[model samples]
Target chain A: AQRVTQPEKLLSVFKGAPVELKCNYSYSGSPELFWYVQYSRQRLQLLLRHISRESIKGFTADLNKGETSFHLKKPFAQEEDSAMYYCALKKAGSARQLTFGSGTQLTVLP
Target chain B: NAGVTQTPKFRVLKTGQSMTLLCAQDMNHEYMYWYRQDPGMGLRLIHYSVGEGTTAKGEVPDGYNVSRLKKQNFLLGLESAAPSQTSVYFCASSLRGTSGVAGELFFGEGSRLTVL
Candidate 1:
């Protein structure tokens, strides 16, 4: 069994401040991690995957094997960045199945 | 392109009533999934299909059933509605599953179901 945990239920930050959404995972085998976002009145979309090692909308996440963590970070928060974010994990050889975390609602205030 | 579309955007059902949520994808995906979202639980997979004729149970498949008679369509059925079944259902699809690659999911707008 695999599990993904997003510790924070809600995170609020002032515009231009740095923000981080913490995620942890428990999986026996090597795992694939991803971050997904859902904006108000919009469908959930993929923000980025760990393997991509690329930033999207100024947000980046680094998967740490030793600590079993994948934290999403943004250098400077923007108002438009406010949204619900989910951290998900897929065990190796598990097909396309994904186990999602409870999610964190990020609010960027002006 | 209507990547993934779920029918009956919103529905209300009483106890013992039956309903089926239809999901269709036009992206020619090989994998489709049905998940229910609650206030704090995020998304729990109810059922999934890897291809046209095969369906598999997911984490929360006890109260639901699924069918995948066609490659592009996956249907989720609730034989008897329960209060606990009220939730926002999401349909998603991905091209294919490889060993190390976690295929990104394309999701539908979602279907809100209320059981009274």
Candidate 2:
């Protein structure tokens, strides 16, 4: 069975501090992973994908194949970066479907 | 463009009541999906449609039915509402891609439903 797990329910950090949101997955075949963010009163949107390997809003997630982990990280946390973040994985097929993990609510304190 | 839109942004229903949530995407995407958002569960797939008439059960599909009569629309129906079914539903769409190439899923604003 393919599963995505985001261990943290809530993560608190102060502004200018480093941040890390852990995500792990279980899949037999090679998997595709992505991070989605939901801001206040906003729709859940794509933040970054492991494929691109490019940082978005100063956030980066590297897919660790050996550990099946794709942890999201930021050098300096910003207050505005606080929001609900979800990790998702796609099953391979003609009609791809996403399997999302429990979200992490990051609250950047002043 | 309203990329993806869900109707009835807010709803309240009693137990055993039935309701349908509609999701429409204007991106001409071939894939549409329905998911439920809970406090800690993030989002769980309920159902998905590949094209105009093809539908498939997702990770969690009990007590829910989906229809894709039109190319750009996918509808999720709850035959009988339950307290457990009370959640925020989200609809998403994505373009066709294979294996590792499939990128992001565009999501809607979400529809909050409460079952009393």
Candidate 3:
């Protein structure tokens, strides 16, 4: 069984402040991790993937195999960054589906 | 391109009534998935298909049925509507990859369903 957990249901931060959304997963096999964002009145889109090792919209996540975590981080929060963030995991084999976390509602206050 | 499109953006059904949500992708993706989003539960996979004429159960498959009769269309059916089934439904598609590596998912705007 594969499970992803986002501990915070809601998080708020002032503009320009650093922000972090925690995510942890439990999967017996090797995993691929990704972050998806849903903006207001918009469809969900991929923010970043661990395999890419790149940042999107100033957000980055490092997969920690030892800790079983893949936390999303941003150097500075912006009002436009306010949205629902979901952490997802995909097993490394034939099962090509994603298991998503509960999600974190990020609110960047101006 | 329309990417992934889900019909009936908003729907309301009475308890015990049945309805089907349609998803169509124009990108010729090999993988299609149906997910339900709730206030606190995030998105749970209802069902998915790896290719045409193939469907599989997902994380939350109970009370929902799906079909992938064609390569570009996936349908999700609710046999009997219930209040607990009310949520926003999303349809996504991704290209098939070799060696289990997955492609980025493209999603539809979503269909909002409410069971009264």
Residue A4 error, candidate 3, Å? 0.7
Model 3, A5-105: lDDT tens digits are 99999999999999999999999988989999999999999999999889999999999999999999999999999999999988876546888899999
Top candidate on TM-score is 1
Give the CA lDDT, 0 to 100, for residue A33 in model 3. 91
Give the residue spans of candidate 2 off by over 4 A.
B98-101
- Residues A18-55 of candidate 1 have per-residue lDDT tens digits of 99999999988899899999999999999999988999
> What level of docking quality does candidate 1 show?
high
User: After best superposition, candidate 3 residue B30: deviation in angstroms?
Assistant: 0.6
Worst 10 residues of 2 chain B by lDDT: B95-104
- Using Cα atoms, each model's DockQ against the true complex is 0.86, 0.84, 0.76
Candidate structures ordered by TM-score, highest first? 1, 3, 2
User: Considering every candidate listed, which one attains the maximal lDDT?
Assistant: 1
Question: Which window of 10 residues has the lowest lDDT sum in candidate 2 chain A?
Answer: A90-99
lDDT of 3 by residue, B1-116 (tens): 99999998999999999999999999999999999999888889999999999999998999999999999999999999999999999999998874333558899999999999
Better of 1 and 3 by DockQ: 1
Query: Per-residue lDDT tens digits of candidate 2, residues A1-110?
Result: 88999999999999999999999999999888899999999989889988788899999999999999999999999999999999988765536688889999999999
